[model samples]
Target: MEPRSHKLYHLHGFHSRNLLDTYCSSKAEMPFTYEAFMYPMEKFHNAFSSGDFRGDVLIDFSIGPQIQHLYAAQEHFRDIILLKPTEHCILEVKKWTDSRTGAFDWSHTTTLATELAGKSDQSEEKEIRLRAAIKHVVKFDLNQENLTGSIGLPQADCLVFWNILEAISKDLKEFVRNFRKFSKLLKPGGRIMHYGALNCTFYMVGGEKFHFFKYNESDFRSMLSNEGFVITHLEVSQRKAESDLMDFDSVMFCTAYKE
Candidate 1:
């Protein structure tokens, strides 16, 4: 017999969990606000679940455990990089644990960007732009961590970094640094997609507040070009069935590739 019920449950799980989490955890703190994390978390999960690329290696910076869940459920098991210890948790526990004492290592940003760009296909202008677009985004950054030992995979065909750029507080320099890190994660001819909000605010584990970097279509496209990515698909839509929880017009979805 066809496993009709199994298929149905799998299909409904994303929306059901998203809705339930949102309603149940609205008043909770950073990680506890399940909807805030699950919405984007599921989006990224669904993308991999679609199985279009079935990447040889998937590096998810800052979202290790979420990806681990998806990997466990799916048969397509690629090497995964859960950058830093924070990948295992909803909040940056390392940063919180050493908030007063921890020092930020800014060099990793440039190093990662250079690495991703180096691995990308380098054709003429248009081709290069197209590839980079598939690789990087306006707000998010991808960085390399010392997790290669844990992931135990070779070089990745696709690198997926989740929820890095969305938390940047200040300094355009910091933003640029993150952009570079994201750009370097992709191998040549690999693809990248990022999910970011228009205008949103939330609190973290340490009671620190973070907001999205306000961006429109023009600004977004410009950032892509600056990072040497060609914009393939950019979509903006309002959140359905929900009031303005964060005082924003819409959510931005971007998909691009590295050349």
Candidate 2:
């Protein structure tokens, strides 16, 4: 593990909240920078509203308790499994999944989703739908052969992860290894959809800096191709959040199917 790996810190000690509020906020001192990220997310999730990629089960490899990215998937995937690295992240997901108190309020994101889908005033229904769609939140480890301990999880129809690669992977080899492992969780024609930051060296959480993998577009395209995946869709946005909270030059959204 690298010296700055997030494994060195306690996730419950404000990492989740700090990561979200910093990058997810559009009202920050450098709002344009944050707004740059919002574009890809809004555009990406909105595409899920259509049924082009509906599936029986979808796995979400979330870096933290991020529910905003799962809203559009709710209407498409009947069963969703959320994979978190720590117990704290798992509990945070369950809190919102069960509608418990103090769960991070993602209502604004829900509102944005509904509005984008041209279904304004449907935030409550959308939230309820996502809560029900999430069937389980399991602790996961990419380094393990099985990832989810010994649980024999069924191969999913689709797997979608957001930025977890940069958070956990220490180097290029590990990043490639992660994709190899992720392939085993899918059926023959199953696809992997992802959103990742580009050219990011590090990001701050609760005032603590952690390692963030520095990679770019060609790296992903080459990695996916060599790792038995055929790139189908890819879009990258230049860095907009010009804040010191994180140093990412761009963000990437990609979809690839196992070959």
Candidate 3:
């Protein structure tokens, strides 16, 4: 049965507790918010290691404090920039990036990544590499025409986006608009690596409602193409269990290059 009957709640805010305790946690710990993310993470790892998407700069246009997507790009990019939309998220990411006191644990993710790479659970080494690879974690507002005007940042060679467009957008047009703005920050012919929830409309974060635009694989591909992108790789993981924490049919992963 659906948790809370998948009831609708007015979209109000982003909850840190929800983000840390559920969405970012592993399926073993958070079956409701996370559903087997390691599969997509492994796919991304293979795609980046194939030598087709290496770059000098890789920008993480993330909505929350997600770093799993970067596990693949660390070897493929020289510098990594993490962009957050809210102060809370920025602080959350800083807690991990700066190795601050009482940071949210990502040990499971580290272990999973190492195992996927054919290594024997070298989580400490993986964590060290991830910390060394991150160059900056800064605030970024998608509503702005100049995303990082204050810092005067250069365009990125590749952008990693996940769990943002749908969670915050109320409609498809807004999704496209925000997507175009983010794409503009990429250099010509640069690539975009994306992860999205499919057929999700609303989700709960710390008992507060967060909205998601309903969309499927077709909608996503069409939107990417409309914005001058060619998808080179795509994968989707069908949801295995139902929960009140999040209502999504599947998770989608894709790599696309601007035309």
Please tell me which model should have the higher TM-score, number 1 or number 3. Answer: 3
- All models: lDDT? 0.41, 0.75, 0.76
Per-model TM-score versus the true fold? 0.51, 0.90, 0.90
Scanning candidate 1 in windows of ten residues, the lowest lDDT window is: 5-14
Clashing residue pairs in candidate 3 are none
lDDT score for candidate 3 against the true structure:
0.76
Q: Stretches of candidate 1 above 4 Å error?
A: 1-46, 49-52, 63-65, 68-77, 85-154, 169-173, 201-208, 240-248
lDDT of 2 by residue, 1-259 (tens): 3435553322333456666666564454634433434575575575575455678999988667787777778888889998787877778778888889887777767878788778888889999998999999998775577999887788898898788877777779878887677668898888888888898877777777777778889999999888888887898877765568677887788888888
- Ten contiguous residues minimizing lDDT sum, candidate 2: 5-14
Q: Residue 14's C-alpha lDDT in candidate 1?
A: 22
Question: Candidate 1's C-alpha lDDT?
Answer: 0.41
For model 3, how does the per-residue alpha-carbon lDDT over 144-242 read when each residue is reduced to its tens digit?
Answer: 678766787678999888777776566788778878877887999999888877998777677665677788999898999888899998988888756
How many residue pairs clash in all the candidates, one count each?
Answer: 15, 2, 0
Which parts of model 3 are misplaced by more than 4 Å?
A: 1-12, 26-29, 32-36
Q: Candidate 2 vs candidate 3: which has greater lDDT?
A: 3
